[model samples]
Target: MKFIAEIDVMPLKEILDPQGKAVKLGLGNLGIQSVEDVRVGRHIQLHLEAADEASAKSIVEEACKQLLVNRIVESYTYYLAEFVLSN
Candidate 1:
């Protein structure tokens, strides 16, 4: 079976996001305002071949906890779905 995973990696709420701040500030310069506490994150799409959805979810979770996220400063969320043929 094949599965698809969508992962989001972002800094913890207590952490500051310089890039997001910069973008927010820049936006103000462009006449956009009323925005506060902006945050930036990464999105990852993965495809895997596994025996079942549970196995695929475990593998993806391990990958995120061990490599994709910095555990201490960042956090991650993921969703898994069975791959389906369009035809």
Candidate 2:
């Protein structure tokens, strides 16, 4: 079976996101004042072959823990779905 994983990784709330803050400041300078408290994060999409949905999820989780996310300062979330082929 084939599965698709959509993952999001973000800095911990306790961690300061300088890039996000800089972007917010830039936005304010550009007259986009309504957008505040901006946060920047990473989005990843993966397609893989797995035996089942459970297996796919486990793979994705392990990937996040081992490589995709920094446990000390970042957190991650992901969703896995079976891939369907269209004729």
Worst 10 residues of 2 by lDDT: 73-82
TM-score of each: 0.92, 0.95
What does candidate 2's lDDT look like per residue over 1-87, in tens digits?
999999999999999999899999999999999996988999999999999988888899989998999999999888889999987
Residues 1-87, model 1: lDDT tens digits: 889999999989999889899989998998889887678989989999999888998999988988788989899988899998887
Say which candidate scores most in lDDT: 2
Cα lDDT listed for each candidate: 0.90, 0.92
> Model 2 Cα displacement at 78 (Å)?
1.2
Q: After superposing candidate 1 on the true structure, give the runs of residues whose Cα lies further than 4 Å from its correct spot.
A: none
Native-structure RMSD, model 2: 0.8
Residue pairs in steric clash, candidate 2? none
